[model samples]
Target: MASTITTDLKNLSISEPVVIIGSGLAGLASANQLVNKYKIPIVILEKESSLGGNSIKASSGINGAHTTTQSNLNVNDTPELFFNDTTKSAKGKGVETLMDKLAKDSHLAVEWLQSEFDLKLDLLAQLGGHSVPRTHRSSGKLPPGFEIVSALSKNLKNLAESNPELVKINLDSKVTDIKVEDKKVTGVEFINTQNDKVETLNTSNVIFCSGGFGFSKEMLQEYAPDLVNLPTTNGKQTTGDGQKILSKLGADLIDMDQIQVHPTGFVDPQDPESHWKFLAAEALRGLGGILLSPSTGKRFVNELDTRDVVTEAIQIQCSKANNKALLVLGEGIYEDLKNNLDFYMFKKLIKKITLKQVVEDYKLPITSDELAEHLNQYSTAAKDTFNRPLVVKNLGDEITSETNVFIGEVTPVVHFTMGGAKINTKSQVINKDGQILAQGLYAAGEVSGGVHGANRLGGSSLLECVVFGRTAADSIANVN
Candidate 1:
């Protein structure tokens, strides 16, 4: 099903190649996979002048199944465990078969990024909710999520150089409408956001990877009103144009209410842009980090709970105190998050000598020692509680609140839409009425639905790209 050279550029005055709707990781992964595997022509349409949508701004790493490193640690992990954890975290709303497929493919995705793309993976620490160490981070200090996208982008650039006809990337092209005939996508109508010029391109398939609507205040209020105005770490370009467009096309949307709001989003009132500067990945919590409610002067639920659970806990803490809670982090927690900490957080840490100093200076009631004693005691108890209930030790006063407490803002910011055009396991995009539009109209990455059931794990999105990318390519190649 490789695309044929059906149209000549000279005769049609075509300004682009096979049209792609967004320049984010999903869009880029699709283009890179197609070009590298099939030598198909591609045209990436980006609304902004620069590349890197919310996908590039991500700080958390990607989650894959257990690796060789985990094997050495004697950490027993299987695809079944991965699938179970994901579905349980998502409250069984996620599709089990799809989760199973992704679980099996996760490891290969990690391997491909490291072996083929030269991306270094730090498999030492695992993220939240999982017992085994499966989260793979980028080596050195680069943010885990962005490093994967950067590697993919770099590979795409090399592919473009090696094969000039493979891809034609156009920046500032914002798609407004998708043209359809007999319920099948045929072309796209867009405007050059830079010059205010309109353009249209004919294509057999259209992929929407324009990111989620996290940055749009109006949409956030409309969709998840509960989390409206809570600080978000999402990129400004994540306005959910792709999800909105698909909704208009009568796609089966699932789980709009299930939003994953991370516990920590750096907030600085003076600089609005810095309000949601950077996020410390949930991995720190999984590694014994404590979550504190500074206003209430107490620690709440486990920080390692599923994102929604943590969000609810934070909201309750805020409401009970009649104000937004301030998050406290110990120096150990700060050290682990140093690489991905945003400018605001980095400055906050630099000015404060220790986690306790931060609380005293900011006039926050919580301190680090109190939070740490809680975590250390909890960690010791957790070892025996799940298997056998242990005698609880009181850790309230032994340690003062020295942990750094930043004001907590947990609202539903549009992060990523896990739902999209219906696609089979092989990644073939289907129509609204469950009809196959075209043989080669395949989709991978975030544009293809069913990968994530309701909510996604911290690092699973990037893994989806590589897993489905290769699957789509191979399926196309094998199809007659």
Candidate 2:
């Protein structure tokens, strides 16, 4: 509990700390930039009782282009190539300037995190919609999200201890509204859930780092009605608080219907009907995990395709039955994804089983021999019918009836919302008429849109947070 913030409303009249809403990666990163780079004071207001909102649950890694790690691994990748890949996946809704800025500064963002925390993001993977392996993580110790959040939170606490006026973290503080005067944003009004007393903090600038609306029932029903029935990988605090509050002040929202339905959310055997499910990280598929039809016991679609493509394929193929598919991971893949395997197995979301049990328990029409033959095609074929190039070395190199593999049941779930208050590269919140809405209001992270258009590639979400979060702070520094 890093709630080192004071309940002293007396300071509000004299203090000029930049008010940051939310304690997720974007907020923390932007706060870091403000205090460290600009020597500015900040007060982070988190609606949740804990730090690191949805960012703590992130299992996939962060994206970068022309990074030191990529060069060390001899992976030929450039920012232009990364930008082109993002544009292709965005399907025309992505803002050209924002996407270009994201790709260009991606390596700097990765470098900033490593330098600040002394983190060795040595592990790399090639996720969907990327031409090369640029997603960086740890060496399989913990999830990248947890590691980053822990480091950032600890550093902020240390800074607060050194000088309480510099960095303040107020947990369990739910901001209800934005206070404005003279048609310019002035401050924020919030109530600490612990005491239920409302307070106001007046400042020249306000930055919204709150997340998207994936877990909010009312928000989903209002904006993305079709996805209301789907479960989410987001935390309960991710209720679009920033967007709802800011929209009242003429902030223009964009792409309200562009919700991302991830292809794989593990269905727990113990609680299959639970509305909340753990996400099957896309890094597993990047490491050669394959998706098979439960009834036929054969591969149906390319596992490395963009999330939307994979989810649509699963729904189309499994529509006849339970709308579920079997995600299979060979021994090599399980080892590569070791960081996430224990929690997955502990929760019984994934099971360790032999190939024979998979065939018998799933009640497939084909025999064990037929399944082996289909899998062995990966060893000799240049590419499969789905154009899945570069078959992993250990996975499917040799198939046997007694092969030990990890398996899980996966279904489509609402993972990300690509719609929110629209913003430019400078992180200034804009109005519907394409003008800056206020003098001292900014938005970052998933709360601000136009970075990822229709679909978001794996690993890019964290990158967006780091890049835009720091950009918002920089923009404010120039203004102030």
Candidate lDDT (C-alpha), each: 0.61, 0.87
Per residue, candidate 2 scores C-alpha lDDT tens digits across 1-480 of 323233443364334788899888999899999988988889999988789988888888999999999999999999999999999989999587999999999999999998988878888999988999999998858899999888888888999899888888888889988878886777788887887878778777889999999999998999888889887788888788888987888899988788899999998889888888799999988878889987678888988899999999998888764778998888887667786988899888898887888899888788887887778887567787888874544455688778778899999999998989999889999999999988888989999989999999999888999999999999999987
**TM-score versus the correct structure, for each prediction:** 0.82, 0.96
* lDDT per residue as tens, model 1, 82-169: 8888887666674566678889988777777778677777555555566566877764777876777787778776766776566667
- The reply for model 2, stretches above 4 Å from the true place, is 1-15
lDDT of 2: 0.87
Best by TM-score: 2
Weakest 10 consecutive residues of candidate 2 by summed lDDT: 1-10
TM-score for model 1?
0.82
